[model samples]
Target: MRNVLITGGAGFIGSNLALKLVESGSNVTVLDNLSPQIHGDNPELSPLYRSILGKVKFIKGTVESRQDWNDALVGIDTVVHLAAETGTGQSMYQIKKYSDVNIGGSAILLDLMANEPHNISKMVIASSRSIYGEGKYLCKQHGIVYPNARSAEDMKLADFNVKCPVCSVSVELLATDEESKIHPSSIYGVTKQVQEQMFMITGQSLGIPTVSLRFQNVYGAGQSLSNPYTGILSIFSTRIKNGNDINIFEDGLESRDFIYIDDVVESIMLSIFKDEANYQIFNVGSGVCTDVLTVAETLKNVYQSNSSVSISGNYRVGDIRHNFADLTLIRSKVGFEPKIDFLNGIKKFTTWVNKQEIQKDLYEASIQEMKSKGLYK
Candidate 1:
């Protein structure tokens, strides 16, 4: 567990994790393609990467390349697989690209683990909350249930709440536990599910310790504001900075669990040394649900922006109604608890965003790209 390799180690979560590992005396190797979506094609390294410069080995490559993986895996005994296409919306139209990078890339890594001789004894794969589409809910009539993804027709009518399948009554969102059913409404979630299943199945055969962390909406200071594909906070911040109104989808009551970067890194660090985390899937999140409207308003207040915030009552396919993690498993298993609350974390993030040079808000343009491909209506 000393010599560690982090795939996609140059991005938001990856970069933060690498810094912690390096600080703790672990030999860290980062394998990243630095996709132009996150970093410009001919761009300087992100400020996060620059902060960790000269401290660890950096490989500019993709996870699918065998040679690059081999080079990155040299003397590495632990692998943290974080590289993947992240946009849930963009994933709808860019099906092949998402599958190739997420599922196919993880397959290559597992194949290397099986066929290649290496010192890999431990592996951690990043899973997503999206797998439990709409998440676990409770009907007043029905005790506990897993609601289905809201239909476009229903969303068209502005019915943004999850309803019981049997009674058709609006259900309440309970904290989704790891035991929740796997019903991903998006292609990205499906790929992540495949990636996690592969790691667990293969790790068992190879007698390697494996951990799958279902990360909630992860955000923090180092997050790339340039990437409009993910990070609602970053996207909103970018738009507000550019004097653009924040577009709220599906009435803005839809909520998600947002965990700070430091908390996420702590969970991974725990998994590395914790035998209890071996061959287990833990939900890593802030354990609190914050609605889209709240998120937009908070960002606006923090920035003191005159940007108008409005909800369209419009929705996207494969989007969930409400979901937050049940931290019971992770806490009981590894004594993991989120330290940063939502307000404090957002303030820290806003402070970081204010320091960085303002960039073009690509929110609408990215949505337009999705619309052109018929992914967004």
Candidate 2:
């Protein structure tokens, strides 16, 4: 069995990946600082923690520290780097904190790996669709945008200009390929782009097999039900459970390509074990874009609740009007395809949410606290 190290192994995506690896009989080690917002004092992930508590080694430490990296990398053959400060709007206010963790901390990890005794076989990074910024989509070889709402006849291979209805600003509707331009609107996106560059450059120079998976909106079990700073699904689920209004920042027209946690874990495993994934970048998404309104509607329908959804005119800075992934390369390279559809995924998530007997008021308070701290502004 290959020895694998998963950073941020207590967080939603990381923990899910770790569970899969451990179940497959791989020797897995989880390095997590257990940030309060992500994993601290919460019972949502307790089942995961309990399952692997004795089976896998767990280290509580920040990725920004050199000693943490050294200790985590001792017997690891593959590294799945998933740790990051992911609050997009909050990153605008706390620029230094996001940079220090997402960019600076990632660089340190790469540096530590470069000095390891046995040559590390591979390194996989969890990247974001936010790196494409506001207006773009992922393009297919035929140059068709996969998730475009425009009819087949309306989509033209020739360059086309698209405008955000809210901003009225004209933008090119080009789908970002692996070679697309790196334009980040938020500090979170900027830092993620930097992290991807650092891995690519370090891997090239050090002869380490590195791959980056640009993940779309990932949501599933083990997600912190208490954190309001991120995880829109979790936030909405909590609010609905409390009989409170589901707040939409804008007109609820903003769209995203949501990928399930299981699909994400599979993609990471493919990159770790497959020789074809070396030194490459792939998009992990469902190749379909669903808007916020649709998601909210789906949740409400699933819960069989009449919880009112309030579409507040208030908008967050650095909010993208639309973003989705182009999945052609990832499908061809890693043979990865999202198994769960959005409707089914939502059903599964709702079932899980209903089973949890957590306090609803606490989640609402957390949302208010985030707003008060200017983290969600």
TM-scores of the candidates are 0.98, 0.87
Q: Taking the candidates one at a time, how many backbone clashes does each contain?
A: 0, 1
> Largest lDDT belongs to which candidate?
1
Range of the 10 consecutive residues with the lowest summed lDDT in candidate 1: 40-49
Clashing pairs in 1: none
Candidate 2 lDDT by residue in tens digits, 1-377:
88998998877887788888988889988988878676547633565555567768899888899898889888888999998999886787788999999998998887776775754788998888888775354333333332322222222232223343334334445445666656777789999999998998998898889999998889886677777767788888888888877888656776778888898899998998889999999988887888888888889888888899876644555666676777889889889989998888887888888888763445556546557865443
Task: Please estimate how well model 1 matches the true structure, expressed as its whole-model Cα lDDT.
Answer: 0.89
For all candidates in order, the CA lDDT equals 0.89, 0.77
After best superposition, candidate 1 residue 1: deviation in angstroms? 6.7
Model 1: per-residue Cα lDDT over 1-377, one tens digit each: 39999998888889889999988889999998878788754445567667657888999899878889889999998999999999999889889999999998998989998997889989999999998888898898889988877767777688877889888899888999999999999998899888889999999999999999999999999888888889999999999999999889878888999999999999999999899999999999999999999999999998999999998876777788888999999999999999999999999999999999898778888888877876665
Instruction: List residue ranges in candidate 2 displaced over 4 A.
Output: 40-45, 116-118, 135-175, 359-377
